[model samples]
Target: MSHPQAKVHRMFEFVEAIGTLAFSEMPNEEFLALGMRNYWDGYFAGRAAPLGLAPAEVVHAVFYNFADGEVARHIPWVWGKTTPAEAIAVRERGSAAALRQLIGDLADSPGLVRVADLATRAAVSAPIEGRVLYAGLRALDVPEEPVARIWHAATLLREHRGDGHNAALVAHGIGGTEAHVLFALALGMRAEEFGRVQHLPKAQLAAVVDGLRGRGLVDAAGGFTAAGRETRERIEALTDELAAPAYDVLSADELDELITGLEPIAAAASTVDD
Candidate 1:
């Protein structure tokens, strides 16, 4: 029998591999030099429009997963400087240029193209996971080479799951700073640790902790209350449910095959480190 989490595993590892295209050990100096204010601006600007969100909205929605100061420092700089469409266009152009520059002849390497083709084929079959990602892909005006398609397909699947997870968080009354705190608590992280990764100021995070405590989702010591643990599980369960539609298009056998094909690429990508 195929593994039950095969599709989930495939989605995550493929996403990881594609992520390395932009964030691997390669120098981003060339990409950063593409006339953007900074790396954050270029990176965030490119995705802003496809997310259908303003810069501040993007910060609020997704910044917790990144560095603590990104929201505070970068949003103000990128917003209103360029229109959303323009910014996304700039981001795409810059990212593609950077990838091309970095990958060099590797862009057309037979092994790379072969893997990309396999990934894209699986992505095409993913209705649920591919929905948001496919929309973003459709909005792009850039030409796709083998490497570009690989990255874009993987990114779409990842973001589709991410967008659903965010929605699940909000639907469960766990938005904003509070969501970050609760998530960390559920994972057994300490307050100080979560604080370092959270975008909220200490004062704000403290307040959020206080607020969650009142709701019995967190203890005074920033640990999860029973209710908190249950809620966190529910959020994850719902997020998986929301993401399942995409994977549903594939049979268990197909999922097994996809995961088998993608794991090596993910391992190779991970080796690049930070």
Candidate 2:
């Protein structure tokens, strides 16, 4: 579970992807380019520093995400007035080798990892969004081995609204895949629409559904069979091991500002803007 550098773990990628997806509100393409993976790399490494994480461990933790396209390209760009080039020689090549050398050097740098980790933790944890997500993950026990395997897989699909992929949690699970296909089917889409949303080949999609049917997960009507319903129930149980947050705390004034723009689309509101 300690895959500071885990894209290679396959299972890690699935779970990590899920954790990432459940947290994002942006579209897939935008999230993909957000440098989130690198941000995490910097984050975990910093923890391993003065907080008790060694610089070497930080490097490894981050390295794993880099392979998942989470880190994507290891390059530098402008950050307001600060460029990575100003302090880190690793930016010179923008390659994994470059990243390694730089991180390797920082392994011995005084107070650097501490600073990075603190900054990252501050930025990530301060958000309302971050609070909700951590609350959820901090509550999980992975249910069963099949779920643990595909949790990340579910994340992969969840993160992107359009980009082609499935959640990481199910990447290696036959039963997981079976559940996934039925879940999608139940959501209601024609073959063409389903084709557009599916991350796998059409045949693969059919096969997953077929496998579920073969195992009696679906009935003759193509809905969940008793066995399939049990699977669905299990997945749902895992999802709610903790209470989901309620978003009803908005004040009349605050809610007014939030929904004011959509008043035209909705009904007229008595709460007017200042």
Candidate 3:
């Protein structure tokens, strides 16, 4: 089978390569100028841990990806292969602009929130999901790219919720449809109630309900099942991960302030998935 984790491998590889720059035998001034210092030190070395590479490898990954243009460049090896001195060379102030663009380009960026509404619930509830997700990323020992897909999937679910409360539901077979229909058939509306609230035609609704029942995420009565429970756990975990760094850096009140910023994101993350 194709590797499901290819994106993770690539992302980690990015970190691994960029982290190496710190040890480049270049001038200390040149190294510092690149903005390659404490970033990796704090992330990979901190709670993220040695994920099959040493501290330096992670930094090298970012530098190489930027030089090669695997990500944002939408091009191939933009910088080509250059000696460490050539790569880090700086002759004029223009170098500053170049460095800034380079940093912005290479950043994992457009964080999930940027691409879509992150959390829909109270920003605090959503952060719980972000914090868990980051933890999952750490546990996976992969880069954030693959894990991002999961978050993107969650964002889709939130959008699905209010409109049919499933604007983004990918037919996950749970009550969420968007949120993986987290609660079971029992928790979901009853058959007659569905008749009243459902946006789908009667025939289509029956089919959809049948599909959910077959999947074991729901029952005839629309109660939750073990599989459905797992889906919620996964979403909850991801949200927690996204919010953890803020939680760590900010005081409780400060964290609340940050959550306020994340509200839009939480809404976006709950999308309907396929």
Q: Give the alpha carbon lDDT tens digit for every residue of 1-274 in model 1.
A: 2235546755766675655455332324433554556666666655555655545644554533453455656565655465566665554554445555555566666676665665665555544443453456545553357656666666666666676777787688876567677677767896558754454566866777888899999887779889998998888777667665556656676666656655665555555544
Per-residue lDDT of model 3, residues 1-274, tens digit only: 1212332233222322222222223223443454435222222222112122323333333222112111222111212222222332321122222222334432234553332222212212322232222222223311134223223223222212122212123233333332323432335545435422244456655665577668776555666667755655554444333323322333445434434433333333212110
- Candidate 3 Cα RMSD after full superposition onto the native fold (Å): 18.5
Better of 1 and 3 by TM-score: 1
lDDT score, candidate 3: 0.32
Candidate number that wins on TM-score, 1 or 2: 1
Backbone collision count in every prediction? 2, 27, 82
Kindly report which residue stretches of model 2 are placed more than 4 angstroms away from their true locations once superposed.
Answer: 1-176, 190-199, 242-274
Q: Residues 135-179, candidate 2, lDDT per residue (tens digit)? A: 232233322222221222232222221111212223323343454
Quantify all predictions' global Cα lDDT against the true fold: 0.61, 0.31, 0.32
- Badly placed stretches (over 4 Å) of model 1 are 1-6, 20-31, 49-114, 122-134, 141-143, 195-199
lDDT top scorer: 1
TM-score of each: 0.73, 0.31, 0.27
- Candidate 1: Cα lDDT at 24: 31
